[model samples]
Target: MPDAGTLQLSGAGTTKTLPCHAGYLSVSGKNNTITLTGHCTSVTVSGNDNRVAVDSTDALSASGAGNVVVYHWGSPKIVSAGTANVVRQG
Candidate 1:
């Protein structure tokens, strides 16, 4: 298991810089794939940024200079910062 849900992501963004955060990461299962519906701040994703996993019971939360939103089943969950990971396969 992961020591914590949100792991720090080193490099990402338009400048291609790394912000030590765990934001805007996507996770999938064997049966289903979950796409991030939206977010609070500017998010960047690459192979390195997407380096973690999560459970259905768990979720990724994030907030920056702008805002953060976590959506599950069309509902919203809030957090200052968070991580999302693939749990199982369908």
Candidate 2:
């Protein structure tokens, strides 16, 4: 189970938007596009071919192959443990 102010998403080939609220955002699915609004404390992505864009974040962890994560602001800590994963500031 997720803690308070945590948002979890899982699915394939879908696009969605959600508010981060300075909390955690977790995504697990293939070929999904997720956009997070506001500041996020952390973000975790654990599925193949996923795309995530955040307005701001303190940390980002990606453990899935072919995943892309873009942060618009802040120098977030990044951990990438998957093949072909991309995490960058945009």
Best by lDDT: 2
Q: What is the model-wide C-alpha lDDT for candidate 1?
A: 0.28
**Model 2 lDDT per residue over 1-90, tens place:** 223388789999989988777888899999999998888999999999999999999999999799999999899999999799999999
For model 1, give the 10-residue run with minimal summed lDDT: 28-37
Clashes of 1: 12
TM-score of 2: 0.93
Q: Can you write out model 1's per-residue Cα lDDT over 12-86, one digit (the tens) per residue?
A: 331212222334443221222123322212222223233222222234443222222223332223334334322
TM-score of 1: 0.23
| Candidate 2 steric clashes | 0
Residue-level lDDT for 30 in candidate 2 = 99
- Model 2 regions lying over 4 Å from their true place: 1-4
